[model samples]
Target: MDRSSGGRDRILRPVIRQFDLKDLPAIVEIDREVGGGYSPELFMTFHEYHPQTMLVAEAAGGVVGIVIGFKHTPLEGRIFWLAVKPAHQGRGIGRSLLSAILRIFSRLGAVSATLEVRIGNRRAQSLYASMGFVVDNVIPSYYSDGEAALIMRKIL
Candidate 1:
């Protein structure tokens, strides 16, 4: 369901809004569902570091996806921690979240946006590529599991 449209199928309706402390559990669930669980410490770290730019997508009475991001003043760029629940994959949620983020970056006058994705996450790579991001480099051992990360960037 599209919250913007007030449709009836809202059973898995999509809503996009700023992050709140109350939304942490849903965020954590999405993180874990995506095989990228985040600790309370890390979750707090995310909120403390970037409150204004973060967004959550709620569907079926739970948080189905999340995008935690913020602008880096020195570099005038934005980076994010984005994930969606496995069951909710293939929907336009990720794109909506990314679009929201880019709007925030544009508002901040960021010249570019950057993010890192595990090399094996082709779906994510495809999403970024479709959104106009280019592969910038590979960062070795970027994950605790020793997975390398594909660094991508979008020049606004």
Candidate 2:
């Protein structure tokens, strides 16, 4: 599969939009599918904290991807989470979601953005790198399972 396009077999282009309360379940499902341990409350709290930066990618009437980000300073932002349904992975949904969120961050006066990715998640690392994010440092045991995290940053 060409991870960038939907492929000939799939025809729907995911529409990126603000996250809605109704889309919480789909977001949670995607999180779980991607090995995240976040609870529904965590996601809800993120949405409540910054609903404008919380985004979802909808395709064929269903949420296929989600991203949660927030401004940390006047010129700095962080992307807390970004995931796409397993079946929808490599179909440009994650890319679209990231692009949309970056746009939102840029408009909010973000001069740079940061995110932490699991050291083992090479696919996501590739995506982030392609977006101009570079590994800044390594955080030891950043996850509950004792996995280290790679801190990535991109100057806009």
Best by TM-score: 2
- The number of the candidate with the highest lDDT is 2
Question: TM-score for model 2?
Answer: 0.91
In model 1, what is the error at residue 18, expressed in angstroms?
0.7
What is the C-alpha lDDT profile of model 1 across 132-151, one tens digit per residue? 99999999999899999999
In the predicted model 2, the residue pairs found to clash are none
lDDT of 2 by residue, 3-36 (tens): 4544575544788899999998888889989877
| Alpha-carbon lDDT, every model | 0.80, 0.90
Runs of candidate 2 exceeding 4 Å displacement:
1-12
